[model samples]
Target chain A: MDKKRIEIKNEADIVLARQAGRKMAQSLGFGPADQTRLATAISELTRNVIQYAQQGIFEICDQSNRKAIIIRVMVEDFGPGIADLDKAMEYGFSTSQSLGVGLPAAKKLVHKFSIKSKPGHTKVTMVMTRKRV
Target chain B: MKIPILQLKNLLLTSIQVELTDRDAIDFQYDVVHKVAETGAEGLVIDITAMDVVDSFIARALNETARMARLVGAEVVICGMQPTVALTLVEMGRELIDVESALNLDHGFEKAQRLISAKKRMPG
Candidate 1:
């Protein structure tokens, strides 16, 4: 499966990325719940990409025959990376003025989530299944 | 811009009737919370069905309203949570622990009635 990538630079891009995630999920016949979850997760991550990273790329990939889709979003910037992954995942923890629910909410929406970050880069990957309930 | 306060049986329900877009969300939230608190209502029903998206700020304000209402011995119920709004909230991970939510206005009223009734039944 070819990876589909979108470079996000602002808040508007976050909205577009969410719509894209929902469209892809719907086209694959995922349930409404799953579709909403995926769209919301993507929106949260993409917003972070614009706010914290200043820019990032959102990539979507289809896993053949597994009835699953993989969303790998990488938000990269020269900004300071998170010093504590654990604290970053904690609810109500935020470095910005906005509500600190971004990372934790994204984690809750997917089956598999992983985060890798350095002093200048952050990559978050989440996997969702297309199987109907 | 005006949120009407309605009284139903011992419970005072205020419908949050505002068209808050992302642009005015911050101001709208602050105004709503303060007004609801001032009304001294026993309960509040915030209808956000007109809102298609709720950013982090709006979510935070809702949480703040819930807390404030509880402090004043009132309950806060959020209604008209569209699917997109719900998804955004879940994604933001904003804890609505302080505020109860329903799919629409009618359902929210039903739930609020139950909660208020239950509270009355509790041993004082």
Candidate 2:
């Protein structure tokens, strides 16, 4: 259960972070489907960081045991926080001319998701767990 | 990296062989449209068989590129999407809906040609 942190600065950082997430998920015995889910989720989150916050950090860790495996991810940025959390979470609503599915869709990929934001800081946390077979 | 766009008669072909950053995706959209216009191509087929991740940004870029190519008088076909990518997209709320797709490169070319000819027969 080692923790890893990635810096999110630009579009390239988004790709790097997602690749790292997928690699870690694969090593932890996750399936292709779940790996993809984690990777895609990370991609969206990091993208939001770049688009809105200009920069951020992507942190990942595993908390698991004999019968189940849990993956935890946190993306945080010190920038102008979201002006409206409710609208940002709504599907098909985007101020940046994007698909606006980044936040809500990312939430669906993981088992647990939460977010908090203020004037200078925003954090999104996600947990994905699967029982080992 | 800038992807190479090849030409075959009235058709233009390109394949995304690596994962692209957001800038690369936008550059690609620009490149595809300019290529179509430069060649006055009738059909364009983009093969993304090697791409493993088509997140919302890439998906939007692809759909936008398709729209721009169509506006510039070329029919577009996107082919060879990985099943996992397709599954992930579906889970992400149905992206890539604006473009035509096929099973593989051969089918993609055929589909693009069909679309091109179909448009050619239009009254306008």
Candidate 3:
């Protein structure tokens, strides 16, 4: 398993995280479409970190075995957590002036997604898996 | 990174060929709108053939740019969105619904010209 962690603090970090994630995905044999999806997913999540949390940690890990290759990502922040998780997931429900599609879009791009948030902490985890052919 | 906005007659042309940060995206939006107003251009073509990812932020930036250009009486056509990027954008549910798009730069220029002429023929 290979793991890499990046600090998400500002807009530049958002770009950095997504590029690194895309590079990792490419190195792991992900196709062009999947690579773009992974990069876009990372972009959305890291942007949320900058906009909402002010800072966070973005981790991408590769856990590939004989049968399948699994890529897992974790985003953790220490900002004021989402008060209404369900509402936040809804389309067009944005606290800011944004389109509010970040969280939901990130979720949709990945294979598995889950979120846990409190007042001072929020963690989002996502996984994408492809069978080894 | 600075995206150069080139003017050709009554049309403004620009291509986003870099991995843009949020700041870059916002700057590009501002630059395009300002260029449109300065040149009194009737049409604009933004090529994103090099952009492999069009997340919600970039998508919103492009949409806002197009809207701003239209407000200044310019027809905007975005072109050269990669197939993978389009797929990802659709799956993410953040479509660029507010903007006009074409398959490539040539087609986009043609479409933008057509729209500009059509608008000109309309009585204001």
Number of the top-ranking candidate, with lDDT as the measure: 3
DockQ of candidate 3? 0.92
- Which lDDT tens digits does candidate 2 get at residues A10-128? 88999899998898889999888889889999999999999998999999998888988988999999989988999989998899878899999899888899999999999999998
Pick the winner on DockQ between candidates 1 and 3: 3
TM-score of each: 0.66, 0.96, 0.97
By TM-score, who's the top model here? 3
Looking at model 3, residue B98 earns an lDDT score of 59
Tens digits of lDDT, candidate 3, B1-124 = 8999999988999999899998999999899999998889999999999998889989998998899999998999999999999888888884645588999999999999999989889998
Instruction: Show the colliding residue pairs in model 3.
Output: none
Q: How displaced is residue B4 in candidate 2, in Å?
A: 0.8
* Deviation from native of the Cα of residue A66 in model 3, angstroms: 2.0
Model 3 error, position A96 (Å)? 1.3
Compute the lDDT for candidate 3. Answer: 0.91
True contacts kept of each: 0.35, 0.72, 0.96
Cα displacement (Å) at residue A40, model 3: 0.5
Backbone clash count, each prediction separately: 0, 0, 0
Residue A47 shift from truth in candidate 1, angstroms: 2.7
Better of 1 and 3 by lDDT: 3
lDDT of 1 by residue, B39-106 (tens): 65566677777654455555766777677666776777888877866765665554633478898889
- Name the lDDT of candidate 1: 0.69
